[model samples]
Target chain A: MTDMSTRWKRTLCVALTGISIVTVAAASASAGEISVWVWDKAFNGDTMREAGEIYTKAHPETTFNVDDTASQDDIRAKLQTQLLAGSTEGLPDIVLIQDDIAQKYLQSFPGAFEPLSDSIDMSVFAPYKVAAATLDGKSYSVPFDSGVTGLFYRSDYLEEAGFTAADLENITWDRLVEIGQAVKEKTGKQLLDLDMNDTGVIRMMMQSAGEWYFNEDGSLHITDNAALKKALETYAKFYQADLVKPVSGWAEYTGAFTNGEVAVVPVGVWITATIKANADQSGKWAVAPIPRLDMEGSVNASNQGGSSWFLLSSSDNKEEAIDFFKTVWAGDQDFYQDILIKRGAVGSLLSAREGEAYKASDEFFGGAPVWQNFSTWLGQIPSVDYGTFTAEVDAAVAAQLPTIIQGGDIDAALQAINDQAQQQMQ
Target chain B: MNPALLRRGLVYALLSLAAFISVFPFYWMIIGATNASADIIRGKTTPGGALFANAATFFATVDAPRIFMNSAIIAVVGTALTLVVSSLAGYGFEMFRSRIREKLFALLLLLLSIPFAAMMVPLFVMFSQAKLVNTFVAAILPTVASIFIIFYFRQATKAFPSELRDAAKIDGLNEWQIFLYVYMPVMRSTYAAATIIVFMANWNNYLWPLIVLQTADNKTITLILSALTSAYTPDYGMLLFGTVLATLPTLVIFFLLQRRFVEGMLGAVK
Candidate 1:
């Protein structure tokens, strides 16, 4: 009995000592060091690193540590877990979150993120981008990229189908369906690739008409949303016309388009880099304004997946991190031009569109001023309040996609989406 | 041809087809590493002449040596510690039976049903309170007491003969000495099998380590590879090259331990 008691005491002492050692190590973190967490090393990560260099050039004592070791999903999980646990020891000074899901993070974990409008000028960014991270009249994000929608189609394939670039400009979804059917018949290829699990096209179509899954008061807007019903009807038309080649996940989705199995890819401007990487098809592709839904208020422009930089309130170097974002991200037009040319990252700064890089014509798209066109459309995209339940509603839409594609009733599908989203929101 | 020969040929053909299907993705990965990113995206199955370029790009972009070192240290240290602690506990539970200990062991099996995601928040809080966040100790500590490994060792320990313990006792060997010199030598095969399973688990561990390891310099290859794959314009050639390099350690470990690993499984069954 005495031996067991002594062993237990020794174990307790050792455990306490071990914890103290870890505490001492953690306490030795250096001052003036701001760490930023980003997911894509090629795009945002390297951009942030260059921004850090620019900042450090001016303030020699301050430094930046940018870690891009986690994927976006992984970073989201880590951040959500740490924030929910209320332990901020391992959180980075800054993180990049997608604009669509920003509301979820902002509303669920209030006061966890620092509102950047407190320090930076929010008016300098595109209004739609700023509106995404704004809540209760306080904006929390430094706007980064603009995922302005574009209808990237193969000029060669469209030409084979006897259509001009003018035919694609400012078109509606019904006109796009006719064009897609013509292209498929003439070229013996599918017009586009659609993933059943992705509701990106539907969301883009709805947002083009200034509608979302929720109304201004954050209530479900599914049953009577005319824009949504038209979008779903358009989505079903592609499958009925046999113009869409079904694919799964990012690789297969991109592969279908890249391998020339499909012609058109209606995606964000961010995919320009991916489309341009196949240099053999340099002049084969052209970008047009995205097709709007056939609705009362639909427009030619829309937005898709974009992201913004957020500062964590728990940051030890909060002031330095804010200054770094201000100096490099907001004020530097030349830096935006560099990332635009190098990484194809289109920044949301309205002034950046005036830079020489954004105005220049590209031989890749047969000398079309694609960047200039993208900048113009970026302005006209209608703003909508993407409520905290975009992901839940997106999943609900995806669940009904298979049934909808099989010629199921559009009203029934919307009802099903409403039911699923209602259950998930709870 | 004889009917038996025809049946044998059919069976062989089916086995070959199954093997090819099983190994195609690995073959595709190798071919992908040898091709340009554009070619891979185009779904080209044939090998191309871009292997050296892909390797150069991967090495240029990734801090390969540092990331591999971090993975090695965590997996090696975590595996060794887990083996010693879990094996000891397993042996104790099987040999020195008690009602409370048995109940505790049963409760542990039930605990295994709870997913890691459910307990991640509480575990993070505990490590944060200890101020061990971002340390290798934090990544290694929570995994060292893995209940699945404990259950594995416990079941294997049942196959350990009681006569060996009795004979060691008659030879005046203490419990600790018997555990070390007698039981350990006899259970070498069991240790070999557990080493592979535990090492693989530690090497591929993603979630907890991603949450714990904060700095880029401290990240493992798994996390780095995942980040690479999620790039807006992912370079498949460079990404697959990193995967081939990352897979080598596990392949080498399995190759070295396969003979004893097989015997260990047979012993457990017996």
Candidate 2:
């Protein structure tokens, strides 16, 4: 009995081992496809798949597997884990990382992304977009979307409140606050919906003047930075004067104005598709230049959120990935035109603005040249060095937001932010 | 006697209330699936006209059957293998309590406390070396030797009747025979509980599968739901619908196992 039982155990162990070897062999025979990782199936993933189709039509041998199955947060966690593990085996050939987290990866892992400046003409892309990806002057990333802010308002609502679109064009934050209050009183609709947790609006206001949470020397630039102070003070003014309808998240923020509870959505020009989604509100909508800060150097145009594509240095197929991006993303102007019409994506390729799509006017905006205006504003968005610690600093600022709204001392809050952000950055 | 009855009543009440509290999030999730994105965000409690609309959008956009198949294969294969391996180790640790193996088990317990983030990279590097990356086998292998399950089996095996094993040994039955026949049949409840726990964990597993599973055709439902939420302007109605579907497997397993697990746990305690 003992001898038979021992033989049975040995056979069971050997069988399991044999099965594993068989599974591994099956997985290795199929390996021609290049995998891609990116967030946003509707936005970036669909865009990449379209670009991939363009590539495969010419080169039938090449194929792409774009994994739009992970969220932005999930991709970050997964990518960071695999890369830190020094395991490039399962990593995607090309991954879409947000511009803010680009430096974090580049600096942490020195050999993670290939310098695409060698393969593609980095100059054809926006300078600020290039700046986000450049470390020690070797640029990475084929720049994707631009988050050029615009003041999209209901023209009908503004007219009812006895104001004009021209009144919003090139106005300062202080003047807009007064206008917002007056418009609210007249129209019984808030001027804008403000998400309590987000600091995007304030960051946009600060960056319009070409300042961030850091100095030109890359030191903390809060506390006494005039632009920062003005941005916060102006932000408080929106809430205190009841010029804003309070919101909690993206759904609520988009809901307020889309449902006509508010008059304006001063967000990135990327939101145009969403605004125009209500075809019933088409001619009623018009965009003004984004409001400027009440301080010097603040422009009517500032960026909010944007992302760029980076090629992995560890990829076996680097040349193909770079060539793929350059062909469709960097070179194809018609492709840009199509994406703009289809997805409301504004490409960072400066030459793309000169495409036929840019010249077209929409009946949706009452025959206004909305795309032309966006292209003009895209040029004026003040360039800022979104430093490596933007994520850490942003989290710190978000933590103190309730205090900032309650008229807390800007200096004290800045000091608190600097302390917490410094701790987190380390 | 009256005071004792009151204490027992209080205990049952408290346990029932705890179960209710644990279950409310799932109820809220179900309710959210029935409402529009607008109403869901407003914290609406009631169902709305949008369940069919939300469901239709989900079925249209997602390859649900393929995703479900991927999830099912991983969970079932993973749980079966985990049970076989972990139960052996558990039985081995209890029946053969020697100094060297006990010390090794202690070390494994310490290893369990180390966060997954720290070990993830090293494991990935090993998998990459073997060229096992992006395979379901890669996803299933590392978790099969779960220390938590090993610990669980060892504890439960303490209650295992040694007298039965002694009687079998006297009847000339070997260790392997005793384990397969006597131990396996006796520990049916333990196997059932472990199967549910391990199956649920593998089904809801996100980060590892997200990293290792490279292709959309190879993706699981959790990954799909997560991706749906990350869009520039995600359709929340569709996203919620996906989450409700993603959360169902774990909920189903929990409900099915709860009655038996409760009875089994009570019997073991008594």
Number of the top TM-score candidate:
1
Docking class of 2: acceptable
Query: How does residue A135 of candidate 2 score in lDDT?
Result: 86
lDDT of 1 by residue, B121-231 (tens): 998877766567777888899888878777877888888888889999999999999999988888888899999999999999998888878777778999989989898
What DockQ score does model 1 reach against the true complex?
Answer: 0.51
Encode model 1's per-residue lDDT on A35-92: one tens digit a residue. 8889888889998888888899999988888877788998999889999988887677
TM-score of 2: 0.89
Candidate 2: how many backbone clashes? Answer: 1
- How well is each residue in A180-211 modelled by candidate 2, as lDDT tens digits? 88888888988888887788998999889988
Chain B TM-score of predicted candidate 2 relative to the true chain B: 0.89
Supply the global lDDT for candidate 1: 0.89
Query: Which pairs clash (backbone N, Cα, C closer than 3 Å) in model 2?
Result: A85-B121
